[model samples]
Target chain A: MKKQLMTGVLATLLSSTTMAATDITWWHAMSGQLGETVNTIARDFNASQDEYNIKPVFKGSYVETLTAGIAAYRADQAPNILQVADVGAATIINARGVAKPVEDILVESGYGFNNQDYIAGVRNFYADSNGKMIGMPFNSSTPVLYYNKDILAKVGVDAPKTYEEMEQVASKLKEQGYATFSQSLTPWIMFENFKSRHNLPVANKNNGFDAPATKIMINTPDMAMHFNKLKDWSDKGYYKYYGSDWDANQTPFEKEQVAMWLGSSGSFGGLRNRVDFELGTTYLPYWQSMNKDAGRTFIGGAALFAIDGKPKKEQQAVAAFFSFLTSPETQMFWHKSTGYVTVTKAAYALTKKSGYYQEQPDAEVGVKQLSLPGGEWTKGYRLGFYSQIQEIMHREFDNVFANRISVEKALNNIDKESQVILSRFARTVR
Target chain B: MEQRQQYTHSALPYFLLVPQIAIIAIFFFYPAAEAVYLSFMLEDPWGQSSLFVGLENYTILFNSTEYLKSVVFTLGFALVVSFLSLSIALLLAVKANNILHGKGAYKITLTWVYAVAPAVAGIMGGFMFNPHIGVFTEIFASLGWDFSLYTDPFDATFVLVLVSVWKQVSVNFIYFLAGLQSISYAVNEAAMLDCESDRRRFWTITFPLLAPTGFFLLVINLTYAFFETFGVIDTLTSGGPGGGTTSLVYKIYRDGFIGTDLGGSAAQSVVLLVLVLALTWVQFKFVEKRVHY
Candidate 1:
């Protein structure tokens, strides 16, 4: 009778320890300072409640982490939370059985989601057809124009706010023998950001949100003219081609060799520490003919996904952690440390009230740009295999910049090639 | 006379071979068969949805101009890299074998690059050929050459070949050096007595004897150029400057992993496998005859 009592006591101890905390694993790509911020948020959440232990794991770059997560899901070892890049968002979302919709998770956990709580551009980007949130927006960024103040001052021009003004400023700077402008060969800044800011559709089917995108829609006259203008700038030596390497132009911009550059707002905090020159930030220029006011710039960073097929208790833990992530305090802390845009209005207001924007006005450019009124086309890209499409764009754009192909030919080639990829993706879904 | 082992009839011999066969079956045959099966089907990135579209992937690949261009580029790249690396390494190996002073140091220095991984070599090459602050870029600038790897296809190809050949030469060098050292001293002395010129003696004695090694290295170098250069291409150019440097292996990787076009990538791998098989067959059937044992 005494031995039986001891066994009962051991069983009780084991069960109590196991039931004390539900461990929720989060596979993220954030590293360095950003990684530290992620860890802090996890630690804070763990400290606040003992029911869920939010475990954050650094899983390499955005691509590597997404690949790992997908492979893990296939093997039935997926984490509760997986961070996927903005481009890979479609891939993750299209895998219907792989992800548990944020709306469902939140509603089930008794913390219901309000679409209005998130910035329209951000919330809409991760929303489904019925406008329900599928994933939680975490680290978001938009491209903005950055210029060297002393170099622009020498050319006697303030930072150009429109495409026409940018060209005029380029001409003026060229007259002074300055390499007036440069940008990375990334289609993120040139195509996606440019199209959204000009209120143009990148692909058909309402930028692929209404249905699976079937064809390329970037062959319009407006796109031709915009590309031609860039070609003209290149021919006149007013614009420098930094090749396909994304960070190549950073050196020239920092060295003041290139007067103006289009760069990610996430780089603002790091840039301020890296450069010695006076820097200026502005919204990316839009074609006035297309839209007098700039449309909202889409977010570029990754979002957190709740993997499906986990236990209800585990998913509830994930939902609770996501609520904490969307809280204004966590958002503001993330923005301050990483320079990623605040995804929610409350976070923006809270950050503003703390005087963070006033102390660093340049950091406000990305957030402000993201919060601008947006049209149907201004929502983030929802195309499948978007990164691969970007690679095709990179190759063709490089061809144009190298003088090997004309702009029209390059666009046509991109259209034809991207159509093939889209059709293939569409075939799978069908 | 040496006794001929009749182990072919024994179950013990077969049992002994089980591990090797099992490894080959698991590692090679299974993946190859899966690739063949996948080639006929279209699948999404995560294997969530699949559609069996027989011959469509291959037909599309053949019709696609981009794939055709990549095929031509890959073939040309392999040929050039193989030829250049073999000849260069052979010359260095011969020099090192002949030299008595600092021979050990020279050989060690030449062989050091073999220890570096392909990705590491690509990274080092990337640093040296970086457009903005690369050492080679500065050198080219001083010489008044308009050099930009990101913009110029020729420049990109040149850098790719240079890095690939540099990475591969050390392995070929070790083989050639070993081949040179293995030539019997009596044969060299006899050739020295028979031939008046040192060059003539080398061509008559050393060249033919080293043909076996050269033949082996040619196959190795070609295989390296075809497949092993994926990391170098990925890190240095990522098959850029209008896809001028993309090889078949890199394309398979880009299509499958990056683009998530599983069926298309699978078809590409099958094509590559066939191409490699044909090349090997040709080499062993035709080229091996010229190589003296």
Candidate 2:
């Protein structure tokens, strides 16, 4: 009789404990090591509070997860939280009734969300013209130059600070029967970074941040001249075209086929594990003459968004989870483990105070590169139908790289196609 | 034609037909109807509100040069994949049917290729054609031709078509093999006694008997090339070296699912449905008459 009574009491206690905790689902696109970090944040947050639980789900790539989010939202089944890439910010912002701005959600709940606490470039990337935080920046990154130290020593050349010097070094490397540089042909490096590093305008309205719509101004003499140089380099067998895939581009560099690689800052951890030779890191190159006053590099990683139209309890739980994720301790742990830039200033200061950069110099390059003051264009490009516009850029670039079209034609094509997409998106928003 | 037993009650026929009708209604007709409905409206990513946009979506797609290019590309791709897969599989099936020793082994080995998913086949193709570290690239380099598929549109599209054909030949092989097995040995023996060339005998008797199967396989192969090669194109070229290999189905998937352009993608899907439907009808109307069975 005493055992039965004890069982009934324990069952009742379990049910009540479950009732008190509101579960908030976070659908993210982080995979492999980064995926582990996502789960760790959720697990820690759940363990810290009995009032809420965060459920982490892996939903393939950014495009797929964004598509999934859209489908679910249409069905009124969106998760409480979502992870959207930097490129998708414009679309997410225009999702009027779908995504609740992180600032709005926290403010509504009477929770503290300091917009100024995040790194300036990150804050700008996830903000609107009013600098209102729409998404909480997480796992943000930028492109950096990675070189094989052995090749650098053999060639007797220091790291390049400008595009002109990079060409000279590449020419020397090519003469010695070595491929000079390889990189994935992405807009981050091919289009946006070049514009940012050169201090050139990517669009008419400061990379589409100042207005609801903007026309591209990238069809200019600066871009054409730079790509003309690239075309010449390609003809000389110095600039090898790696496929437009990130993982595929890494193989040529890791196998010592290419001496220098321009890749994502987040790739630091993986490259360290795989390469047998000592590695060197530096900021991306600038156009010395045209870009006398260059700006900071643009970021490429994703951010956390609090989804809209959930129950009040669930929305509160999501706000609690965001605070947990952006905490200095959690951000620092995430930054150290994945080589992604820590989003918060508190996390940045904490890691620096611990002398983390002194030990791993390569890990600091991304943070240092983005530390420079950023204007509207330098914050990053954010435009609706960005994925479509990106594809258009890729297609034009591909044709140019294949020698089917001149750089002038490619840039012209990109400008024309992008305007159409932007105009369509403008209509949608209206 | 095979004989069927007559059923007395009309209810029994309708009863037997219920499950199939229900399945067709739920799975095929319902989604198709929804796709048509969606094609007429501007549906945002989050489906909170969808506006009626009339023919704007279709007009936009029609005006885009890339969409038209994809139409021509898909037609060329489907033709090549269909012809090559059918001819190659038929030749192999003929050889395998004749071989008395290790026939099952040969058949099973050829059959297993179909078991591989389209995406897996594409990934395998990617490894072989990857310019940076591919074994085939090295081999071609040594032979005085630098066969890099990454930068060249022709090379990339060729790989997409080749991998898709490699995946589809297995299904064609099974049907052709079954067709070859159905022919009686006695007929061939009787023809041999009359003293004609073996090649001529095959042309006159065996080939004609295989027409019904060939026609069936051709229709299936064309449809496979048109509709089922999306994953192969995705993993192989991603519709580049400059949209060189973007097929109709692939564009629909990219626009609708990846880019989240619901109205645009739905419009494209509706067009694709009509195109395939007309093509199938034409094939049945003109080509099926020649089949001996």
Candidate 3:
């Protein structure tokens, strides 16, 4: 009777162990190569572990994915993990109780939480004012200058070292019948890149990353100067305004109709397979007459946040996945596969030691550009209504480009709209 | 007995309308009521916490220069596009009605063009007018004109209006043709016997007879101009050349979805809904009375 009871207990234990493996849903916006990379990582993790199984789903683009997640949340069917873009950060933050802080998840899961492991510029974005990390650093990237070497060589213009040099090269390229120096005039490229390269403040409180209630500083002298440059170039037919965002302007670059393009470094992997010409990567140019050192470019990619309202077991699983995601090996795999900068210092060191940079020079540009001192603007601006500000800036800048208004008037209008939005956002936060 | 039978027959029709009423109540009326209710409330990023703020959204909208400008812009666009499309469609329909030999072929061709979605037509039109590779751009440049629709607000608006008319004219054309065909040949004979010229007869008799169709087309074209052309704006200009082409619906999309200002967007949407409803009612009261039928 004792032997039969012992056998029965062993059988029940085996069945319960089999049933313990839980499936967690992860909703992401990545597709194509990036999507495959996410799936591969999830597969590797699942294979290595027997307790939790992660199910990855490609929802859509960043906005679409976020909208879908919100809809799902309304229906009480949200995913366990969501990858939100940098622009969506404020929205997520404002969505209190809807997201679990990564720091809390890590601690609860018994993992050692180290905020110092992440790059300061990147980590600061995911952290609250009290210095608690809110999200996991996933694929962080910054904009860089991408030039067609053949076109540059033909125009006798070496890769532009300064904004003035870039202007001169654009003229030469236009003279050589290139017709367009750059395809797209994306607001981020025009405003953020220009602001960071000049070390100009886009807002108070270190471009709003230090304080959320800070107002916009877009109508400043530096911004005016930048606008003037763009306007002059546009008038001179050196810059062809593609109208609106970068996606609309990508056609010309893919066809080699444009000489230069300013876009995220994350595009390197995708462009590598498409472009027929030699693509040279360089740090974004600054005002030549301004200070020689402007620091690193501002980061412009998304991070993964652990949503709130899940069971402790699920939170523990998410934390383990997050920790594994930021590990050096995983970072290297992500960087090599997607051209996004590895967020961790250890990953960068590993890449250096492995001589990956020597093999692929394009990957080195992002690291070198980000290794600079990252001044006030380069720290990555965060505000409650940045997306609105961006839209207003783009609208006003487009007006400037169209000669509908003077650069001064456009800047003033941008300031006015931005102030209104900022004040409204401040009231809400309070 | 006959009066009782007529009452029972009328009751069947009322019973038949019940399902449609249920559908409209569930889908349209409920959401519209909810939008109005939410417009008076403050919204957050998560779209969860909404607090009632009586008339705050409307007051803010009324105070905003941007919102006021968009209102004017949307009104101008809707009026201009509707008139242009109706006039062109009426002319084409009349011309096709006069043609006896190839009217079928003409209608088939026009129908094919109309069958193509507005988005596809907008894309094709964008490429055709694109400054870089567009044939129209080459021609305009050769004529010593700047003619860059992307850079010029007037030019962008012109392109939008032209595309809007092109996409909508076919539907109105069919309506006009149907109206013309339904008119008895006896009316034209009587006008002729009264010594009215062909142009005079058309203006006095045929045109008046087509008023009902015109009114219907006006409502449809105006709504299409307001809502359906969001794709055209998105694909062609994206409300650019400095918000010169941002319609009310497009503004709602940009604010709500792209800018993530749900409260402001919902408020804007409520404003748009009210404007549309008011205009539609006015059109019905004034214009619909002109329809003889």
Per-residue lDDT over B8-117 for candidate 1, one digit per residue giving the tens place of the 0 to 100 score: 46688789999999999999999999999999999877778889999999999999888899999999999999999999999999889989898999999999999988
lDDT of 3 by residue, A1-430 (tens): 9999999999999768757977789999998878999999999888777788799999988888888888788778889999888877877765678789999999888988887787655666677765688877687887788888888888788988778888778778888888445645465776766777677776776666555645677778777887787778878877767666575466567677888787777888788789998888888778867768767766677888888998878888898888888888989999998999988888888988999988788897887777777665565666776777877877777777777789999888878877877666655552
Which ten contiguous residues of candidate 1 chain A have the minimum total lDDT?
Answer: A214-223
Off by over 4 Å in 1: A1-19, B1-8
Candidate that beats the other on lDDT, 1 or 2, i.e. the better one: 1
- Chain A TM-score for each of the predictions: 0.95, 0.95, 0.90
TM-score of 2: 0.95
lDDT of 1 by residue, A332-422 (tens): 9999999999999999999999999888999899988888899868876689987888889888888887788998998888888888888
- Which residue pairs does candidate 1 place in steric collision? none
* DockQ agreement of candidate 2 with the native complex: 0.58
Residue A192 of candidate 3: its Cα lDDT?
A: 66
- Backbone collision count in every prediction? 0, 0, 0
Query: Candidate 2 at residue B109, lDDT?
Result: 96
Ranking by DockQ: 1, 2, 3
Give each model a TM-score. 0.96, 0.95, 0.89
